[model samples]
Target: MATKPDIVTLEALDAFDALIDARSPSEYAEDHLPGAVSCPVLDDDQRRLVGTLYKQRGPFEARRIGGVWVARNIARHVEAWMQDKPAHWRPLVYCWRGGQRSGSFVLWLRQIGWAAAQLQGGYKAYRRWVVQQLAELPPRLAWRVLAGPTGSGKTRLLHALAAAGAQVLDLEGLARHRGSILGAWPDGQPQPSQKAFDTALVAALRRLDPARPVWVEAESRKIGLVQLPEALHQALQQAPRVQLQVPFEARLALVLQDYAWLGRDPQALARRLQALRGLQPGEVLQRWQVWARQGRLPELFADLMTRHYDPLYQRHLRADDARATMLVLPGLDEATLAQAAAQLLAGGLARVGS
Candidate 1:
């Protein structure tokens, strides 16, 4: 007699040797549990074909056809992917809603003498857990918001703090955006889907100790296309802030270094600047584009800082950060930022958290 496969909930996930996502490749690509390996029981096309058959020919015909395809795929996986598994290997498998794909896979693995289990409610259950934890976790931990104008190197400082052994949550880093209109990564890496971002965020949060204050950059509710969960955004807003004050020239130099790709691909920079078109006068916008086309980046960057970014910062960011503890830095070089980070870890920023 075959041993019955176990069904496990979210809490039991870590006990397994491997996490297998049995959903289609496309579904796995969109979002999945952190550290899950894609071992789809049905390929994207196969899943589509099976669903269409179910709709057109009724459940009986669909199952008859689908079972053959599923059996062949499972055998292929066992041969190609699981051949090296030891006798005692245990794996957790999940599909969209703890349904047929994962159930069948777990059944086969159990018959083969491995301890395999299906996720109780599959990816949907994991997603719900992510949402609930995100809603609840941010409130319990203390947040330290880093408030600074554009080009002030908030992200760099976050890195510096992390290197100095401080608890840091770089939301923009996780979102794959810099939290600005021009914030798309220069390397052309696409941002993760909102679901993926949430997964990454929660995983990062889970790693941190709640007893320590988490330092995060002050950001708008949305970072590129991903919105911070409401609880987190609220916690960040309510947290004490550390204001960074850098001189205009230092900021300009930092921007030039950070966005050096803008200088190399001025046309790309010109196109991105178009996002600010409605806000800036047509002539001003036209001139900026012309400067971009001409490769006159320093002048274009300075104008953008003085005219566009500065005004917006004054109007928006300055209000709530009025009482913030100010750290006036002379430069944004790595050594300088590292020194500042060290001081912060030395309890320079403790009062604000308190």
Candidate 2:
């Protein structure tokens, strides 16, 4: 006879052959296990309908209606999504809280002689582990902070550093954001949920060598919609720093190059400029808006830098203990960045005076 499904902790996830997520699609979109497949038993609409039924008619009626919905969806999922399962395929299943959803899925899988287990405390347990990691992980890292004005090639430099075999934890890249008011990518991809950000952050941090310095850009505590974990943010604030000093005109050129997509639509550029109104004087803001409306990107960028980005950047600099190194470059071109990366790799902290 087949036995009941075994229960497993979040720590034993690797022992299973596969991890299956049975939460609603909307829930999965927010975040899930790093490799968990979405095999939702109830889609978003069905979940809302079932929830409403439970509130009005009670759990009996809710289950009566929801049971059919869940059964139908699960059958379809097995035939279409899980048809390749081998006889010995053992999967770990989880939902929001290891409740009826995961319990029911594990029951169905076991009846067919598959070895399946429900995660104890479900995704919530995994979330707790992530929290513990964020608190503990940053301390283990040997951090080297990169700071510069808005248009400085901080992110690009991080990419170059990683490519040169340096250990790097790119928090902004993991967040899918550029870490500013215009931080959103031009193509309109949404930033990952906070949990998703943290999950990816922890994974990235674990991959780095604690013995070597982990390179990161200086960002505010919050990057776009998600905030950095408190411990990591604090570590960043106190880490030894490197400042990149690209020439003002060259920095403007770099900013235009990096954000060139924003200049494609004059009106769209104007709309973005409006965000700086409160920070800039009325006349300065008006001129900037007009410059944007006319697609005068260089002039608009210059004005924004002098009137906005430069001044605001000072606030960030004030928080730094003192920069360990200042790499002044003629520009932020590929050659300059490569040289800077080499210096970082070969010099270590002693190169600060150079």
Candidate 3:
């Protein structure tokens, strides 16, 4: 008979070679541990059916039926997914709350001579730790907030900073968004669930060194659909600010390049721009839509920036007066941003917390 399956806590997460999330596919899709592979003991349909049976029939009846399905599914996983896993391979397994699904999977693997273990409290425990870390981690690190108007290439510059070996927290990247009214990725890519975003944000923070200041983009509390934790928002609000000043022509060019996909579907682009209807005059919106249909990108973007984005950004700039140190760049070219990144790293901004 197999011995009681080993149970590991969140603190010992790194000890395992692989993480197997044994929850249903839908549950796994909503959120799972970073780098975890989904190995559900019950799929979505089976889980729903089991839940219905539990409610309509009774707990005992539901378990009697669910057990056979769960066992067969686990067997299938062992044959198909575990075919190549060596006898010495170790995997950390977890379901919703370290319950029967994961426990049974671990027992089977352990009996096969693999050193498999179940998380003490499963994904639920990891999620709680994520929430706690999101609250605790940001305040401990020194942050350099890069502030700029839309189209100023803040994200691009952040990428350059990372390439230049600076510590950078890319909140937009974590959210899988550009953080704008038109932020959704091209081809309709969806953002991760809020739980998943928190998981990624906490994992990113854990990888950084507190000794070095982390450079991050200035943002509102919300990025696309994900909300920044209160502590992180407060930390960013209180952090040192570095403002980017790129000429309007350069900013326009940067925006057009970044949002080139907008030109392909004029009707869709026009509909998206309608989010600014109240901010822009009706006639101006109509004209912009016309330009969009005509594929007149330069006119469309220039007018959008001057009439919509710039005015809003000016108000924000006024509020931020006396708080930001300016870093003026003639353009947002790769070479230019790379040079600016090097200057910041080799000079003043790099000296802030050092």
Candidate 4:
């Protein structure tokens, strides 16, 4: 009395109860369905041997060998799947292209009396959909840029706006760099590839309501090693900018607070300070190095902001002729920043004339 559930497309699978990518672990790790968890039907070594057999002996022999491995794998997965399943759970399972691998899993789930569907065209099809979505995002979304000087807490403000019911796409958070030499996190994870960045941006854009403004930080076309997609870069260039201005003392305090943990590692802090060499002459660089070594972190931070960061910001501001509405926060305290951001959201400040 068992019947196969209808297969679903990637779009429909997006709304399904659970997404299961039944590819090998290595394949899932490299790239996969956006929110999918891997439940590989082939271990790494078996997958490699199967692939080799396919290339050398053709599909028939490969399938024969793969079938044996897959049968055993499915028996193991059935136990694991049962452990994961709730009585009401329905899962959309996918493999490379809704081929034998996914088909076999789908059949097994049905035999077990679970409601499961395969993804039509599978992971390859899903990737193609992601690519198409990224290619078409610019004309479909309303974007707003949050522009500010270094240490102005633009990232923090974006999160605040999101909490206040604003749609937000946090680029720096996605790229995992704060967009500066000193911006690296202490843990220092590298940013995703440019391809991955675009994929993530498109994913975020897809979730946002086009009618509501999606706030993003004003960044250079590149964030660390990753470059923004041309359409996204252009969109950012054209979006209206909300510039945040805090007092120099407040800015310095914010920077110190943000980087306080780095103070313990003077050598590392000095190396980060040294990254500013190109912006300053030999003398200024040497002076900063000495200050860094001497643990004069506050003085070092102040000089870098005034001499290097502020000037760079000024140059960009002049070049862009940006329509900036300044949100002046008296201090960088969370309470003050949150209030100022709320006022900006309420349109409560003077606009900078172009």
Candidate 5:
């Protein structure tokens, strides 16, 4: 006899063989549980059709059409994604709010003799958990803010720290943005939604050890489209800092290498540059576009630093007295960065200056 499977909570995720999401395709693309697989009961068009029916015709008509779609889709999913599963294989399924879609999917799986369960409160519940984690988790761990200018390789050093077995939380990487107007990807790759960014941030924090300090960049209140949770932003502010200072020319070279994509599409680059219009003098902006047109990236980059980024850094990122350590690197090449990283890790501000 097929038995009814027990319902599970979000906390039970680890015990399940697989976590399946039964929302529409568009829903899954925005964000889902960190590892949940997409098994939409109704695809994007089907979902819209059902909603339109519910709004235009009546609940009964919508159900009649939706039920057929759900049934056929679930049948295909079980046969394709779950056919080889052992009889004892257990899976947890969820939809938007533990409603009809997940309920029906679980019922069918149970009938097939698989120990499947539906999540209580579904994706909404998981999202709540992520939000709570963000509000609480940052306070639980010590933080080390890696402070630097726009092109000081702060992101590079964070990765290096992690590779050296130090803990890291790469907020920019999580946001899919580099945290500047010029920071977006060259081909117009979009940043993550706010909720998507929160989920990713929580997942990253969960992997870290509480006893160790987390190193992060000196980001502003926001990183592109997503703002750091209020408490986490506070934590970034209060953390001890490791300040890195490099000459303007070195940073200019570094910025050029990092943003070589500007040359590929000068028009897009010019538009992004224009965004600095009010702050940059009209003559400077005109000169920037001219150099960009001529592919004079080096001079343009140098002017941007001396003219734009440098003033901003001095006003904002510079610490008056609490500099934990300072490094004036001659250059930001790999070897020099590695040496500087070693110095920071070694916990000694041995007064290195080129």
Candidate 6:
């Protein structure tokens, strides 16, 4: 007699053939197991109606209605699974918890002579593991901070370093913000919640060897609206920094290149620039607004860099005593910038003197 495979434990989940999330679409969308695919057992409308029935009627009546829906959904998934399943496929199915939903699916799979396992404690268990990993990251690894002034191309440099085979963590990229007042992208996507941020950071760290250097951008504790995990923030504070420098004109050009989309909505650009009000004095703010209206974008950006951005950067530099490594780019051309980044990262440049 053949025996069925039991449900998977958290540690063994990564090796599972497939991770089927059997929660409703809405439930799945709210948050889910990191790599699980949605093969919902109940659609959103059906799930809501069942919930209402369960509250309004007796448990038996609710279960009877739910059972019909669940069986239909399971049959569809099973057919799909059969088409996709390989001979060696050993699926791990789960729902909100290792409850009736997953149990029913697992039983059906077993009856059909397919080897499928449920996830013990389901998605909730995975969330717990993610939280634990992130909360304890500081004690497990050392980080290297890559700090730079505004428009210094830190994010782009991080990507360049990654292409050169260095381990890099792009914090702003993950947060979906460029880390400035005008940094929001056209999509206006909000960053993931702090819990979600920690989950992602921990996952990135897991891929790297802790003994090796990992590069991350120098940033404030908050990137736009998302606050960094405290443990990782503390690790960043202690990490040694490699500072980058570019000529003011080059930086201005880089800023323009970064925000090239702004050319289409000069009014929106003006508004975003105006958002910096009260941070600077009224006269300085008005002057910048005039430059913006006159369409002197380069001059406007230069003024902001000198009067607002650079001063804030200087303060952080004084506090950190960062080891500034100057890699001067001749121009903002992609090739020139990439070459300059490569030279610095490849240890081809002399160390900058204070």
Better TM-score candidate (4, 6): 6
Tens-digit lDDT track for model 4 on 244-313? 7777887888899887877788787788777777779999999888888888989998998989889988
- Which is the leading candidate under lDDT? 1
RMSD vs true structure, all candidates = 3.2, 2.6, 3.5, 4.1, 2.6, 3.8
lDDT of 3 by residue, 92-174 (tens): 99999999989999998888989999998888888889999999999999999888898888999899999999999999989
Off by over 4 Å in 4: 1-6, 56-61, 83-89, 189-199, 269-294, 318-322, 351-354
- What TM-score should be assigned to candidate 5? 0.94
**lDDT value, residue 71 of candidate 4:** 85
Local error of candidate 2 at 243, Å? 1.2
Which ranges in model 3 have alpha carbons more than 4 Å from their true place?
1-5, 318-320, 348-354
Question: Alpha carbon lDDT of residue 119, candidate 4?
Answer: 89
lDDT string for model 6 (1-354, tens) is 433357777777778777888898877776677787888878999888888998999778878999999999999987775676766777788988788888888888777766888888887887788777777766577676767788877778778778777788888877888888878865557777665666677777788787877888888888887787778888888776677766787788889887777666666677777788779998888887777766778888888899899998887674645355545545556665567556756666633221
Query: Considering summed lDDT, which 10 consecutive residues are worst modelled in model 4?
Result: 345-354
> Model 5, poorest ten-residue lDDT window?
317-326
**Model 5: how far is 39 from its true place, Å?**
0.6
Q: Name every residue pair that clashes in candidate 1.
A: none
Residue 282 lDDT in model 6? Answer: 86
Alpha-carbon error at 283 in model 2, in Å? 1.4
**What TM-score does model 1 achieve against the real structure?**
0.94
- Shift in Å, residue 278, candidate 4: 5.4
